[model samples]
Target chain A: MQFCVIGLGRFGQALAVALANKGHEVLAIDRDEQRVQEIEDRVSQTFILDSTNEKAMKSLGLSEFDWVIIAMSSDLEASILTTMIVKDAGAKRVCAKAATDLHAKILKKLGIDKVVFPEHEMGVRLAEILSSPSIFQFLELAEDYSIAEISSPREFWDKTIRETDARKRYGINIIAIKRKEPYTDEKTGNIDYREELIMAPEPSQKILQGDILVVLGHNKNISKLEKATR
Target chain B: MKQEEIEHLLEEAKFYILNNRFEEAEKYLEKLLKEHPQNIEALFYMGLLNELLNRLTEAREYYEKVIELSPNHEGALEHLSRLQGK
Candidate 1:
């Protein structure tokens, strides 16, 4: 896919690098000369011109790209203006970076294809890890829904995966397991026995102590798992 | 190796922080760091927690670490300067 990313901040630069690395054709643009130079080698092309300038966007032949991403995360005016210009310039898909809920709402209202909240998104992820230690990971699916990976609490230890009635009672589907294995000493060259759990396991699979259970369910259900296990 | 998992964790952490659940937010961040020690999101919020609790030295450490990881990290630089009595 061809991608045009505007605003060469950290987030934008990272996204461009990742996408380009994935073999996609990427055109990275920013008003800052230094920022443009930073991504020069990582992308198919680099531009130091302001994306908000319709003339500049058109001159660059942005219409040839399949997708345009406006990444001016901190500058609302620049982001909005850039989005409008990209759309007017005939980009097939336009994605924008938003700094606030209001900013996102406005961008959506303006018909930007996608609105990303990089800072807010990062903040929420770190918050989850702090709130539920038993839950190794979690993702909000919607307002009331979520998917979580939780450590098997003491109560579930030695029980078979089906015994918990996870799907029936907690509305959680066990997705996978993360197990810690014993390390071998280079001198002794000994392999020690270690515990492991079957991931996306069958109903008959057993749940052992210290096993991390990857699960998917509603937020409330996940919380119940967290409290019960912890 | 889906980025979604890491992204999801960061989102939840931010919500908890906004809700004033400092302790809860800290728990999530710690776990995240254990898995991905170099995660910028986890590092940034650890700084936030220290700053909020008035543990200026610790907060400064985290903020400085963030700048080290991403030199152009405006947020970290801004907060670190504030914490340093600048």
Candidate 2:
């Protein structure tokens, strides 16, 4: 896959580098020479040109890229103009970052394929982490639905999935279980841990004390389950 | 069962629940409820057992029953209020 990221802010730079690390071709563009130089070695290509310049943007032939990302939320004019130029260039897909609600609405109005608020999402993630320390990871699928990884509550330490009755009781599904098993390294005479992931754990499988349960359910039910940990 | 025997059963259930032996607690509570359906202590303990097991709906129902029987029951009222707030 090929991706074109306009703007060299933290979010855009990270996205470009990550995509490149995943073996995708990434073209990182920014008007600042230093910003472009910092990431030039990490991505497939880097260019220092004002993205608002339609001629320069069109000259890159962005239409051939798999996706174009407008990541200049601080400069709304530049972000919007870049999005328009990318769309006019007939890019396959376009995703833009919005600094505020109104910016998001305008991006949507512009028919952007996707609009994201990285700062807002980070704030939400931080709040959830602080409120539910037992939750190792959480992904909100929708307003009322989420998938979370939480440590098994004490009451469920030795209980099998069937006994716990998680689905019927809390209206949540335990989709996976992650456990760490310790083994003595014969050669080194030291203990090492191996991670085991159980996908679609069976009803008879017992939940161990240190197991991490990956659950999917409504947000309210997930919160109820989290409260059970206390 | 005699009043003393009913009290004994509720005590045993409470003990099991405190020790996190929810299955045993549930058994005792179930037995007490069968013989003394209106026993406030038995109903409250059953509600606590359900709450521990994250069977919130069932816990709420049990708590509601206790409140129905004894309007001024502190434990039942508190537990039900907390569950409802969730």
Candidate 3:
């Protein structure tokens, strides 16, 4: 993957360096010569150029970049202009960090859909981790829907799918179940737990204690189920 | 094994694969195949398990077996393309 990041503010620099470290080709750019120089060794290339300048923008030939991120935190005009320049020059995907709601609205009006406020996403994820039980791993699919690996509900223990009839009662589907089995590592010769998955079990399949149910449905239904199990 | 029994085995194998429990997953899958040599679902999963464990050649063979049983298996075809670096 090819990534072009304009602005070497903390957020942009971290994003660019992380991408480069992941083995993706990154071209880090900033108007400040010192910022550009500091990142030259970490990324594939670093350049000092005024992104809004027509000749400089043209020289980037943005089509070569698969993803362009405008992370100009302090400078709104520069951030917005660089976003416009990159999109106009045909960068496949453009993401920009918005400092405020009005700035985000302007980016959307300019047809950039991948506008992000990093702190907001981090906050949501942190809340999710803090609230959910250690057993369940949740992935938010949308505002209302999510997929979670939750420990089997207490009421479900020793019950068959036919008896539980979860689909009708909970409005969620148990897509799979994970169970831990004792085993020895092939290389280490030490005892360890090996988890196994059961996909789409039959209606007659029984729910056992300590089983992790991979459930997919609306977030409300999942929360209800989690409360009942707890 | 009954259909329900086979399902339980596949489920266990898939769980192991998800948790990076390859050896245990392989044990269940191998036992599954030994009992029901022509189970296409189990065959497909073995391929997936191998793919995740970075056993490319073994994964390819397992996927090919699934294709042999069910020629139009979309998962197998897609995985084969990835294995061959298409």
Candidate 4:
């Protein structure tokens, strides 16, 4: 896949890096010379140019890219103008970042194919983290499914893996366990493990309170576990 | 004037308010008010928090304060009128 990412801010940088790491060709552009220099090696192409200028963007021939993502989170004008130019340049798909509902509506009216709200996404993730302190981490897989890392709760403390019917009762499958280790060598000259953790723990292992459990399941089941832990 | 800090807190409060986290939003706005006691935006938002929480007395007090501090605060006057059964 070929991707053109406008604005080299945090969201844009992350998207460009991830796509490029996944072997997709990514063209990253920003007006800031320093930011473009920072990602020069990571992406297939990095350019410094004002995206709001239609002629400047046209010079790059953005229409050749398979996906064009406008990631200016702060500058609504730049985001809107870039989206319009990308679409007018004949890009098949254009996704724009919107800071608010009004911006999303305007982008939609201007023919943007998709509107992304990073703040809303972060808010939802923060709410989930706040609701489940025992969860090491969580990701929204889809509308119904989720992937989460839940540490063994107090109620499940000292319980063997076989004792709890998490798979049947909660409808969650434990994919792996993350176990912690100290930094020091117990038998020889001191060499610390430095509180590092390991993943894909044995299935039959008893989960301790601190042991992080990686689970994949539906959102309802994930919420059930969260409520139970709470 | 530390306008940047004020704006940051206002943004945080707005986010919490939009998510229906009234208590958190109130905390943020209260801190912001302590820093800028005469801030019309903070006063107006404090009144909004009180109204959403159904604390009519506190809401009225904050709304009245906003009007007193800045008579031209359009939102505060509108909110105050709505709260006064007018």
Candidate 5:
């Protein structure tokens, strides 16, 4: 696969590096010579070019690349113009970053369907994390399946894994347990806590208060447990 | 080759997918992909068609290909993320 990224900002650099690491050929471009220099070694190729300039942009032959990503997030005008230039240059697939909902709407209206809002997406995920404090972490697996680490619900305190019947009732498997052990520091004479993880514990493993339940299952079932614990 | 022609073929593949004609959808998508191998929509729909047929690994392959060709595609990333259980 060949990818042409038209901005070498943080997001663009990350995307280019990730794609390049995946063994894909990537052309990383930016108007800033410094930014282009920063990512020159990370991606397949680097260029300092003004993407909004139709003449210069068209010279890149964006159509030959499998994808052209317009990632000028800070400059709305430049981003929009670059999107237009790429499309007009006969690029088959183009994805662009929009600064806001209004920006996204405008991009959509222009028939660019692959507009992304990185900050907005990250904000939503952060909000989800904030709202679900008991869910220590959430990792998506395959379609409909996820593995999540969540603090055990109060109701499950002191109960065995079998007693909770999480596997039977919610169709979720408890993969591990994380417990905090308190210890007093010898030199400082202060009490601290250390996390201990038990992997694939026996069904009889006791669930103590503050124990973090590591579970794996379908998203629906995991959500049931995630919400139930809340 | 032309925009309208490619779109027409995409619609045909979409119709087959919606109608549960898995083989037909695959056939149409394969032909479209042969012409434009990096077509994002075709690869994404091919992922969907594979998912419907219970070929999850194949679905992940197609979705990952779409993401490789075009990063951060919402549907492709969402579906591909779900398959990575670890």
Candidate 6:
């Protein structure tokens, strides 16, 4: 995949480097020469040019990349203008970072393929994690539904899926189980651990102590299930 | 079943659903629908049950049936819209 990241701020730099590390061709652009120099070795290409310059942007053939991310939320005018230039150049996909609700509205009105509010999303994720102690991870699918990895409740220990009756009792479906098993190293005479994942575990499969359950359900029901841990 | 018996069965299903005994609710709803196939309440509850169980296709089918039987059914309309991502 080819990705172009504009405005080499902290977020853009991180995104570009990560994409490049993932074996994608990443082109990073910024007005600051230092920023370009900082990441020149990390990405496929680095350019120091004002993104608001339509001619310079068009010369790069923005449409050639699979995705172009405009990461300059701090400078609203430059961000908006760059987005327009990128869109006008027929970029296949455009994602922009929005600093505020009004900025997001404008980005949406401009027909941006995707708009992200990094700070707001991060805050919401942190809040969800803080409130759910039993939840190891959570991915919100909709306003009310989510998929979560939660510690197996005490009541569920040693019980088979049929016996636990999770779907009936909590209105949640356990999709997978993650467990860590101890093993002795044959040559070193030392104990080690290996992680195992059981996908779509059978109804007769038992929930063991220290097992993590990957479940999907409504948020309210998930909270109810989490409370069962106490 | 008699009217009183049907009402009692519906109440039982509703009770089970509210208490998070979805399997028991499904059993009772199945029994009710077996006798009264076109019961709107039974179909709607079945749809809700299937949705909670992650049987998306079955849920959509049940909700569609409910809408077909009664186009102005508000509950069915709302759930169907959500299921269809409308």
Best by lDDT: 6
Error of 1 at A113 (Å): 1.7
iRMS values for every prediction: 17.4, 12.2, 11.3, 19.7, 23.8, 17.2
lDDT of 5 by residue, A182-227 (tens): 4444674322245689999899998875577899998788778877
Summarize candidate 2's per-residue lDDT along A1-230 as a digit string, tens digits. Answer: 99999999888899999999999999999999998999999999999999999999899999899889998899888888888888998999999999999999999999999999888877876677667757777888877898998767887888999999999999999999987554445774322346689999999999875578999999899889999887
lDDT, model 4, position A161: 62
Off by over 4 Å in 2: A182-194, B1-86
List chain B TM-scores, each candidate.
0.90, 0.93, 0.91, 0.91, 0.92, 0.94
User: What is the CAPRI rating of model 2's predicted complex?
Assistant: incorrect
- In candidate 6, what are the lDDT values of residues A1-230, reduced to their tens digit? 99999999899999999999999999999999999999999999999999999999999989899999999899999999999999999999999999999999999999999999999777766677667656767887776898888878878977999999999999999999987554444774322235689999999998865577999999899889989875
Runs of candidate 1 with Cα error greater than 4 angstroms are A183-198, B1-86
| Predicted candidate 5 versus true structure: per-residue lDDT over B1-86, tens digit per residue | 88998989987876665544556778888988999999998998888766544355688999999999889787788778776851
lDDT of each: 0.76, 0.84, 0.79, 0.77, 0.80, 0.85
Question: How many angstroms is residue A153 displaced in model 4 relative to the true structure, after the best TM-score fit?
Answer: 3.4
TM-score of each: 0.68, 0.69, 0.58, 0.57, 0.53, 0.66
Note the DockQ of each predicted structure: 0.02, 0.02, 0.02, 0.01, 0.01, 0.01
> What's the chain B TM-score of candidate 3?
0.91
Q: What is the interface RMSD of candidate 5, in Å?
A: 23.8
Q: Give the lowest summed-lDDT range of ten residues in model 2 chain B.
A: B14-23
Clashing pairs in 4: A183-A192, A183-A193, A183-A194, A184-A192
Report the C-alpha displacement of residue A105, candidate 2, in angstroms: 1.1
Docking quality category of candidate 6 according to DockQ thresholds? incorrect
